[model samples]
Each structure stands twice: as C-alpha cells, then as structure tokens.
Target chain A: MSSSTQTAQYNPAYHRFTLFLAICTFLLIVAGALVTSNDAGLAVPDWPTSFGSLYRIPPMVGGIKYEHGHRMLAEFVGLLTIILAVWTQRKEARSWMRKLGWFMLLLVIIQGLLGGLTVKMRLPWYVSTAHAMVAQTFFSLTILMTVFASRRWIGSTVTLTRHPDPGALSFRNLALLTVLAVYMQLFFGAGFRHGGLHFFPHVVGAGIATVILVWASFSGILRFGNIKPIRGASIAILGLLVIQLLLGFGAYMTRVVWGKDAVQPRPSMVATTVAHVAVGALLLAHCFMLAVQAYRNLAPAAELSPADQKAVVA
Target chain B: MKFRFGLLLILLVAGCSKNETPPASYKPEAPTAKIDPSTTATVSGVVTYTGDVPKAQPIDMSQDPACVLGKVPPNFGEAYAINKGRAANVYVYIKDGLGNYSYPTPPPATLDQKGCRYVPHVLGLMVGQKLRILNSDPAMHNIHSMAHENDGWNESQYPGGDAIEKTFNKPELMIPVQCNNHPWMKMYVNVLSNPFFAVTDAEGKYTISGLPPGTYTLGFVHEKMGEKTLKITVGAKEHAVAGPAFSSADIK
Candidate 1:
C-alpha cells in the first residue's frame, strides 16, 4: 500500500484545535513561571480554596489574584484539552493520536490533582517536580500532535537513501544516542531544579548535554551528508545549552542582587529562572526531532524517487 | 508439607502483627494533664518583625568535598551555629493544663533531608506528646537530644527506614536536637510547661486556653526571645491578649 493509504489522514479541525491547545499550554507555562518566580504558589495559603473562600473576589484580597488566576487558567487549559480529545474521538483516524489524546486528557487531570497535592503536602519537592514534568510532557504531546497533523510530515517516510551514506547505521545510532543523552540530562536537570541542588550539578548536567549535543551535531554532519534541519537543531541545542548555562551562573551570582532575601526573588532571579524552565521545553522539542527522525528511517519508504518511480514492484 | 505450611502461616501472622505495632506507636500523644473547661482562658496576639527578622545565613551544603562525593553528607537548610548562643528557632508552649477542645492536629511531622538539610528548624511537642522524627534522605542520621533541663537521648535511623518515636518526660524550655552522624543536622524541640500554650507564628500570634476564670500570669517566650508577661482573666468567654510584638533588638 502507498504510505498515504496506510497512514492516517490529517484532520484540519483537530489540527487547529490541538494548535490552539498548544498555544494555551505555552501561556500556562509562562503563567506558572510567573507563579514560581513570585513565590505565589503558597501565597494564597490554602489548597482548592482562596482565603477560606471557594473563589477569589477582587479589589481587597491579596494573593488571591495570582494564585487563583493561575488555577483558573489551568482549568481552562484542561477544558480545552478535554474538548479537543473528545472531538477527535469521532474522527478515529490514527489510533495512536486518538490514544495520545485520551492519554493527554487523563494526564491533565492527574496533573491538576498533583498540583493540589503539592499544596496539600506543603510543596514536597518530588510531587512538585512531577507536576512540573507532567506539564512539560503535555506540552510535548501537543507539539507531537501539531507535527503529525501538519501537511508536511504526514505520509512522509525517512529513508537511508535520502540519508544515504556508508555511515547510515552509525548516523542512526548517533541519533538514538542523542535522544537518550538528552533525556537523561533533562532528568538530571529536573532533579537539580526541584531538589534544589543548585549550581554545580546543573552546570555539570548542562555541560554534559552541551558536549553530547555538539558531538551529535558533528557526528550527524559527518555521517548524514550535512542534513540542514538536523544540523540546525544541533546548533539550536548548543545555543540554548550555552544560554541556559549562563543563566544558571547568573542565577547564583546575581542571587542576592535583588535583596528580597538571599533566598527570595529579584527581577534577575525571576527572569533567569523562567528562562531556564523555558529552555528545557525547547530542548525537549529538539530531542523529539531526533527520535522522530530515527523512527522514520527505521520504517520502509513508500514514495519512490524518479529513478525507482517507473519500476513495477512484485 | 501440611505441617510446614501451618508453621509458616503461624510465623507470618506473628511477624506481621509485631511489625505493625511499632509504627502505630509513632502517633503523637496529647498531654495527660487536663484543665477544667470552665476555667480555661485564651491568649492570642500577632508576632511581627518590627525591625528585621535576622536574615538566615545561606548554607553552601556543597561547600564540603565529601558532600559532592555523597560521602560526608551536607546540611539541607541551615547548619549549626557555632558562636551564636541564642538559637534562632525554639517554639515554646505550655506542657499541661489545656482543656480539651477540637483543634486541627499538626501535619504528620517530618525532618526530611533533601539535598542535605533538615526541614523545619524547630519542632514543637507537648510534654507527654510523641513526635515522629523522620529521615528522608538516603543518609544515616542519629537524632541526639541535647537537653539541659530534661532527660537526653540520641538514636540513629537508617535511610528509607522508619522514623524513631521519641517523647519527653518533662517540660523543657528548649532542647537542641542534633544529628550526631551529620554535625550540620540540628533541630530544636520545645517541650511546653502547659499544653495550653503554643509558640506564636511568624506574625507573633499565639493562643492559650483552659484556664479557670481567674487572673494568671502568662509568659510569652521563644528560644531567641526573652519573656513578655501578661495577666489574663477568663470569663464565660475565653480571654485574648494581643501578643507582644518585638523588634529584632527587643528579642535580646
């Protein structure tokens, strides 16, 4: 069968809604950034309640706005995801997308529960990290949905011929290695972020990720005939890693500069933290590309080139 | 086979029962002494930092090479103070005489070691109360009580193991709870004279009750803070006194 026949067709409405969800997810991330930076997570001082009341009322109450506002936005994002997933259920095109949609819906709900648990548990580090990670994972799914639903990637296959070289196997291995390294590095980064094991480990993890990313880029270029997208992603990864490293250093050096407390927030501290978190999201995207490329190459090609197009296959 | 099975079942039940009993004993105990409900009075006030709540020094837990190698271990939050005689955190409460009234019990307390620090620098317990002192990290910790006016004991807990259940025999103004294994791990347990009294919050707020409707002198104190006295009379309704707010200088 042709690849297009075997592959699930893209649903435009579903694609649009998923993109919208992705946008909202980004906003929620930014809002969460603000919340963490401001230390507003505990500002309201109660879980599922604002100052002993169910909902926040305006003008006079402090902390209600930031805390409840993040909550309200989170609920809206959850609702959007549920709606998108349910709507796609009828389409039933790609079983994987449908499954992922349902999974995303379930994860979003669990993520909310985890958020409440964090408050209930008084911000235990592990639960808090899980909550942050679930958000990142959800964002990745939305990115995946956007990619699969797009006209460009749908029905496409990666081939060793397109990536043809004596080193196709090594390039493939390098790609898989890149994903594994990035993932482990991301996990360490998460630990450092949540465990509050600041500075040194973060630097070490970033430095390792940077080295692997550069090695992977050089390996990809040397082996894959200089595929621009892969090269570009590697370059982006390097740039982000460098910027993230500097931000980590900046977070330490300029920590007391704002003087909220040596432990508390300064503008620079807030900005750097948000940047650090955001870059992790971007790094995950680059890692996703590495995995996708590897998966595509593993599968047989359906679209024949000009030379092979005329031949009738047995 | 039948005879062996019977013996194994018997052993299993006995092992499970005894293993469960010890952890159940971890629950905190309310004071044995009680005050008459009719006589109980309440004293409450806000604690606020007027000048400055002295900035806590940042502990570079990573300062030690052993910590980086995950050997000597690091202090998670604040390390022990070397020269400072007055401890920063000591929650003083009454060890006895609080009439029974419904109150939210404190969260199951923990002394989690995260990235090598003991959370909650001070833990408050009633004189007859039980405290669950937990060790969260993978490091071995020995909880040592340096009690000046009360019985002192020290014990160690292995990583991922159960927290030790400890109680105080009598009231103590303040006692230093240290980790002998990790010198930097230090906490304070304040044993109260009356179960009715509690340390004020960060805002300097406290409530005391279960007093007979008569004038009694109540003292407000913290580890680093000196005593503030107030005379209170409880009528049909509980009495309230605005806790004395002191500048950081006044604390001395």
Candidate 2:
C-alpha cells in the first residue's frame, strides 16, 4: 500500500482520470440497482440491440428505457476502464499502478461478459445475482485505484512504519478482516435482493459487518488519531455506516412490511433501495481505503522497536 | 473538470426516467366494429369427454374461513365439471387461416375473487383485451399472472380495493393466475390474437360467430382436460361446419 517511489513523477491528468473512473463505476453500480429493482430485465428482450435497432431512434419509454439506459452506461464505463488501463500503461511511471489499471480493466471485461450472460441466460436467478456480486467487486477495484492515485496518498513519505500499540491488535490485520467481512455481507445482500435463501442471514450479516467496521474505526482512532487520512476516513466510514443502517431499515420497511400487499414497490421504496445500494458501495470503498491506509501506515512487528514489538505477537 | 462533471450530470439525467406505473383499473372501451353481415359466418361445436375423470380436489379454506363462510363447506374449486360425458370450461377458438381482420377492443373480462376462489376457473379474451381482476374477499389477494408466451405481472389487491386491470400485449394459449396468499385460488386465462374464441358451457357447447369467409383451424381447450383442433371452411351467412364433432379421443 505504500506509494511507489516513482509516484513522485505523477501526471495530474492521469490522477484525475482515475478519480473519474471511480465515480463512473459508482454511477454504474447505482444504475444496475435501478434495473433490478424495477424488474426491467426483459424490457429490451434482446441484447446488443434495442428492438433490432442500433440506436434508440424510437425512444424507449417505461421499463425498456431503464434496461437500455443501463446498457449504455455500462458500455461507457467499460470504455473508460479500457482507456484507464492503456493510459496508465503508456504514461504511468510506476509498474504497480499500471498493473492495477489493467486488473481493473480485466475485471470490467469479465463483468461485461457476465452481464451479457445474464441477459442471454434469460435472467436466471444465479446469473443475475452473480452479476450484482461482480459489480460490487469491480466497484471496490475502482475505488482502490482512486485511493492509490490520490495526491495525499502519493505525496506522503512512509520512512517510519507505525505499528499498533504493544499488546493491541494489528491495525492492518483488523482493517483487512473488516474489508473481507463487508464484502461477504455484500455478497449476502446480492443473494437477498434476488430472492435467495441467504436473506435472513444477510440481515444478520449486516450486524456483524457493522460491529467489525466500528472496531476497525476505533482501533484506527487509537493508533493513528493524529494522522489526518486515518482520522478522516474513520469519521467518514462511521458517519456513512450510520446512514447506511438507516437506509437499510427504511428500505426493508417500504419493501416488506406489508405481507400480501408487497407486490408493487412505491417510489419511496425504489429511492431507498437505490440509495442503500449506493451507500453500500461508498461504505465498501471507504473500508477498502482504510485497509490500504493501514498497510501503508502500519508495518510488521520487525519494523517497530524490539522491546515494544516483543510485546506484540502475530 | 467542471465540464466533465457537468457532462456526467447530463448523462445521468438522460438515463433516468419515470418507471411504468403498476396495473390500474382502466379498461379501454370497445369501439363499434364494421362486420359485413352478408359475409359473416358462424362456427359451433361441442367438446365431449369419455372417461371417469378424477374427482375435483377439496380446497381447504380454514386458513381464511372468510373464503368459505356462508358458502358450502368444502366447496372445492371444481377442476372438472362435466355433465353426461360433455366437458365444460373448454376454450374453443379459431387457431388459424383467418386473414387480416381486426376486431374492436372488447371490454375486459372480469376475473372476480370471491369466497377465496376465482369465480370463473377459466376465462378467455382477445389479445390487447383488458382484464379486470377484482378481490371480493375481505382479505388481501395477489394476482400472479404466470404467462410463458407473453409478459407476466404480479399485483396485489386488498379487500374493497379497486379492481386491478391489465391487458396482454401478445397472444398466449393460457395464462395461469393464482392467489399467492390463498393457494387454493387459481384461474386460467386464454389470450388470443383475435376475438374468435369461446369457452364451452356446461353442455360442452361453443359458438364462435362473425367470421369472414375462409378456411380456418378451430381449437378447443378444457381447463383441467386437454385441447383439440378442427379444420373447416365457412361460406357467406351463418355457415356451420358439418359434424366434425370433437371427442375426448382428440384431446392430447
């Protein structure tokens, strides 16, 4: 997670493009949520074409509009990821960053193919849920790129490695565990959304993810309280986590509080669900940023003083 | 950067639009049609079954006694109602050979849910025809229309709620509408591209009128039984095909 030595010679424009890609990927995730919530999977009925037409000459109204628009946004994001990969390969001074770009591009390509498979397979429950799950991972990758390319992250020097306090848990390890748990919860959320068996567990998984995230945040505050990046991300993650919880309950209320009358989704339900999805992406990204920061700021026991490190065990 | 952000905003705005509203109780009024009385013909037939069909299953209504209150106890949703070897609830219609003849949109067939069962076990309507599903029970009922050949929709209707009206945009032989809450409540709806179909009455009788002169394929279908077809030609006036009567042997 430490910035590459060559990162000193950075192209500001490249950094900006990375941020742009991150934002684009975020939007794409939200668009995907809208499509699923609207149940517009069969609106277009055909892939790579809208009713046998190349363009939307006949404007799509209603459900077809949502399905087709998602396709367009996905295509655009795919192109942007491709450009980001090639652009970094051509101009980036650091090899790791360039490879990160390529990794993102590869993930996006796989994601697009999965999306196409979802359509071709007639929107089977498993394929559709996989599509949702991959979007989240792809979103994580884009957010990682943004975190790596940030000026604050690249400008800082990490000569002195900050290990956790004696007898305290490793900050880096805690964050890594938090990220994995959050992603697991996201996977469960995807299953829940698609009407699968993991629904109740998904609800329970939220509580587990929340506890882990808060623990990681507290550890971050205790160990790197004075550091601006750790302090800021911790606060942001905590705040976003609260908002996400509220949105999740609000979504459940509007979606399933009524038993037999749960067929039609009100506009409020749509808004809450979409917002919950967006906030989830944001939370995952924030958690990942914390993980990256942990790796950069905190080193293994060997990097600390021998007496202090002796008090800490792996 | 500002320009790029603005462009992103524009793209987002362009991508999102209002979602299609749920089924509303609005039925298109049927317009007057121009059927040439001279060339119009009629096709009539009877669907007779020859076998000891299984007894209609007893529908349990204890989950919601409101579904069976004041009604006959154990009044099951009759699957097969045959009278003296004549099968009822058979849907008879023209399968093919009718050249371009457009009919006016008829009013939606009302599928009422009373006593926790669909009033009519079988209903038939033309493509683009409206269907109004009413929930007469003092409980919540959801209409889950399962169609393979056309779009399927599931909507909920509360007691005393307005009827949920919907129309099929394509032709499907039969769409099963079920109440997810009351498992025993079920109905089958047949959607045809044209209004040349009829359901057999208790006497296994059907008559499809207002047909233009042409050779046609007639189709007969029963809810829990089977389907059969016939080939016939109709000339001017009320022409009836000779006794190409349909028997249970013809049902596959």
Count of residue pairs whose backbone atoms collide, per candidate: 23, 1
Q: Write the per-residue lDDT of candidate 2 for residues B79-177, one digit (tens) a residue.
A: 667788777787788888876655788887899987777878889988778888888887666577777766665555667799888888767776877
Clashes of 1: 23
lDDT of 1 by residue, B14-96 (tens): 43453354322222355444446665566665544455555554534332233345545322243222122323332434333
**Residue B30, candidate 2: C-alpha displacement in angstroms:** 44
What ranges in model 1 sit over 4 Å off? A1-12, A45-63, A155-169, A196-200, A225-228, A256-263, A297-314, B1-252
**Residue-by-residue lDDT tens digits, candidate 2, A1-314:** 24455445556887888888888889898888887776556555455665567665334443445677788989999999889999888877678888888988877876776676555444546556767767887888887777677676666654444654433567777888878887787778777787665568879998999999998888777667765667777888899999999998988887766311323234676788899999988888888888878776667766667544433222
Query: Compared to the true structure, candidate 1 yields what TM-score?
Result: 0.55
How close is every model to the real structure, measured as TM-score? 0.55, 0.58
Runs with alpha carbons beyond 4 Å of true place in candidate 2: A1-4, A158-161, A165-169, A259-263, A305-314, B1-252
What DockQ does candidate 2 have relative to the true complex? Answer: 0.03
Error of 1 at A292 (Å): 1.0
Best-fitting candidate, scored by DockQ? 1
